[model samples]
Target chain A: MGVIGVVATMKVQAGKEAEFEKVFKDLQSKVKANEPGCLQYDLCKSKSNPQTFVIMEQYESQEALDAHGKSDYFKAAFPALGAVLDGAPGLEFLDRID
Target chain B: MGVIGVVATMKVQAGKEAEFEKVFKDLQSKVKANEPGCLQYDLCKSKSNPQTFVIMEQYESQEALDAHGKSDYFKAAFPALGAVLDGAPGLEFLDRID
Candidate 1:
């Protein structure tokens, strides 16, 4: 009913941070341009670990987040993202309290 | 120089979600009212597990974030919060890229 927030942690392979960032920038742009329900989409680099990225996203609702996952852009981008990640990303989904 | 984002995972002991949330709301108010550099302070509940709360915060800069940690409010609030949490909260600090 309220905002759906997502926190996803990605660990890039040692030498692949730069490459991963390049690919991610495009994905972020597409998320912003294509997904109207997506309220905020931000990618951030960890202060302590340069190879780790934490994506912070907010959607209008749970259904909106579900739709974002089903988008063609996401279908393509997810695989591209997986290839650079060290392991499966840690994802936590939440509903905003305030 | 840029936005400082924080993702903190808190697993509250069962039956404490309500209390934790109550205390947290007060803390959130304190952060917003007292800290000019704190751009955002949001607390969220996990959809699958209500016991887990994720705090998403943004600050104007690294220095602003540092000041937040040293504030009297934080020093007092952190201990009050820790009493309800299951274990040490997982914290990740990031610099927004987009």
Candidate 2:
């Protein structure tokens, strides 16, 4: 199976960018340190809109992608992230061509 | 100056996936071979919708990103790609946090 790529676009609350980023960074570090199946997980802020952010993620396979969502660190970080998010994130799942 | 990321989400016309991919691959190869400043340029197809594709790109700087847009090969591929695309692509420019 090909690698799975996930693009998550989020809009953080006006004053919560810093808090959102801190929580996201904590989650990112945990994912990187503990999840061998995850290939790439990076946070980025939109150039056109300060409130917008995107998480670019890559997993080895379907199982790996599922494992990421079910990981304790990922689940535990949700409430803090949700609190700072302006609305539901837009997610897109793709199959890496390369 | 930090790296710049570009997310280009495109929807190919039904039955034009192969043609669209071929044109995109040709462009991708040229970008990789000619542009040293481009860090990552990947093509991915949507898992949920076959017709949707996303090009994930990273550049060393804003100048590098501009160079890509102005490159001869990039400009040349537009016509073939545009013919197969369903509509204008959704483009998002980002500043890599890490």
Candidate 3:
């Protein structure tokens, strides 16, 4: 009942991948450091498409996701990076199925 | 360069969730048992929709994924289960980004 995962796909602007990576790396570190409920946070690029990125994040619960969304780093970092996105990011919350 | 992840989403038919679950659990076990290159294999459901299922599978490389696809169980299981699906599954291979 405690496990929650987030699946999000983002289309980073072609030339802005480097900047996106920089921000994403910091966000990853910050999420890991400040958020204890965050169990895993992984950043991935599409194999067939270099400009697309996917984030696989696992949290302890829905509360944890809420906490992460409300965190200073997420609030600031995500929006700052949003402008450079090539398209709208697809975000979904997931429940572990047994 | 070895880390590879597969993200696929399936829409299971209503009332056949139990059948899907049974087959899926067996597939999970089989994949884990036969594939050493498979690092992580997890099944997830959408938080808001119980009919939607998402598979988060990680392999050591594209070669590993190809091996998995060609493996006896995946070849048989996926297609057999596909017949019960409500819609076409979305499958994508992902590359690790640093």
Best by DockQ: 2
DockQ scores for all predicted structures: 0.83, 0.91, 0.74
- TM-score for all predictions? 0.94, 0.98, 0.93
Candidate 2 structure quality by residue, lDDT tens digits, B1-98: 99999899999999999999999999999999999999989899998999999988899998999999999999999999999999999999999998
Worst 10 residues of 3 chain B by lDDT: B89-98
Tens digit of lDDT per residue, candidate 1, span A1-98? Answer: 78999998899999999889999999889888988999888999999999999999899987889989998988898888889999999888899997
Taken over the whole model, the C-alpha lDDT of each candidate is 0.91, 0.94, 0.86
**Candidates ranked by lDDT, best first?**
2, 1, 3
What lDDT score is found at residue B16 in candidate 1?
88
- For model 2 the local lDDT of residue A80 reads 89
Using lDDT as the yardstick, the better of models 1 and 3 is 1
Ten contiguous residues with the weakest lDDT in model 1 chain B:
B71-80
**iRMS, model 1 (angstroms):** 1.0
Give the C-alpha lDDT of model 1: 0.91
lDDT of 3 by residue, A1-98 (tens): 85887789999997999899899999999998999999878899888888999998888888898999999889889776897899889987898775
Q: What is residue B44's positional error in candidate 1, in angstroms?
A: 0.8
Clashing pairs in 3: B2-B60
